[model samples]
Target chain A: GDKVKQSPSALSLQEGTNSALRCNFSIAATTVQWFLQNPRGSLINLFYLVPGTKENGRLKSAFDSKESYSTLHIRDAQLEDSGTYFCAAPQGGSAKLIFGEGTKLTVSS
Target chain B: EAAVTQSPRNKVAVTGGKVTLSCNQTNNHNNMYWYRQDTGHGLRLIHYSYGAGSTEKGDIPDGYKASRPSQENFSLILELATPSQTSVYFCASGDAGGNGQLYFGEGSKLTVL
Candidate 1:
């Protein structure tokens, strides 16, 4: 059983459209973080949440510790948004962060 | 911004050969981790360390070994590289405690023939 699971393993969207990605946790996660891995394989941190929601520009994320789930929403998606998205959850009592398999997004004009 | 760098961005090794990947962090974080990414498995933890001279086994530690000789450096070694070990390896550093976020390097791509 995976501690963290991501839905819609892969997604495709037309530019300017909106989309959402989800992550479900089997473990008791205390904190969650989202990252976007560019084609070059460079991972850029998107959001870090304890609980509740946070928004930055066209991206927004929410984490519900009680439900053990997290969501990342992209608004007015652009071609540059094409890349792999990952969500990581920190173990309840450890400093380690468990990562989801990742969701690959391909946005085209 | 926290900086984490990995050396030998790409590597090629023959079966039964030795392979080592290195990671360094300028953030001076206390926790470091190693993970391998495969097609369907995602990112699987291989090893981690809390500080210099400390190494802990992660979810998938077999066939691999790790060394944390200093606070700024961590290395992953494969005594006998196999094709199965061929994948993209990632090194990350994080601050202490569960609330802190982890910062990652670009990654090292290894190919075993």
Candidate 2:
């Protein structure tokens, strides 16, 4: 079984639309981190959460440890956002993070 | 910003040959990790290190060996490469207490024939 599972394995959205990606954790994850892999193949750290919500420019993320899930919301999507979104959680008492399969998102113009 | 850099951005190796991927972090983080990403699967951890002189096997460590000669340097060694081992390898560094907050490198693409 997968320790971390993400919903909507693939998604397509139009520019200026809003969308959300979710990750459900089967492990007792205390924290969550979100990453964006761009078309150039660079993994960019978007958010790191600890059982709470965080909002960045055009992006917001929430992590619920008790519920064992995390969500990332993107507002006014852009073509540059086309790539993949991944959420990861650390193994209990270890630095090794288990990652989700990733949500492949494509934002069209 | 945390900077994690990987060497040999792209490489092609033969089967049964040796391959080494290097990672360096300038953030002075105590923890470093190596993971490989395949087409349909998520990035899987192959090995991790805690500070200098310590390396631990991760979930998939069978064909991979890791070394942490210094706090800023970590390397992943493949004794005998195989086509199944061809994937994009990423190196990350994070603070000891940062939980899972990791900064990743650009990733090294390895192709084994």
For every model in order, the fraction of real contacts preserved is 0.74, 0.74
- Residue B28, model 1: lDDT of 85
Model 1 ranges off by over 4 Å: none
TM-score, chain A, candidate 2: 0.98
> lDDT per residue, candidate 2, A61-105, as tens digits?
999999999999999999998999999998886888999999999
Docking class of 1: medium
Q: List the residue pairs that clash in candidate 2.
A: none
lDDT of 1 by residue, B1-113 (tens): 88999989999999999999999999889999999998888788999999999898888999999999999999999999999999999999998875688899999999999
The CA lDDT at B86 in model 1 is 94
Lowest-sum lDDT 10-residue window in model 1 chain B: B94-103
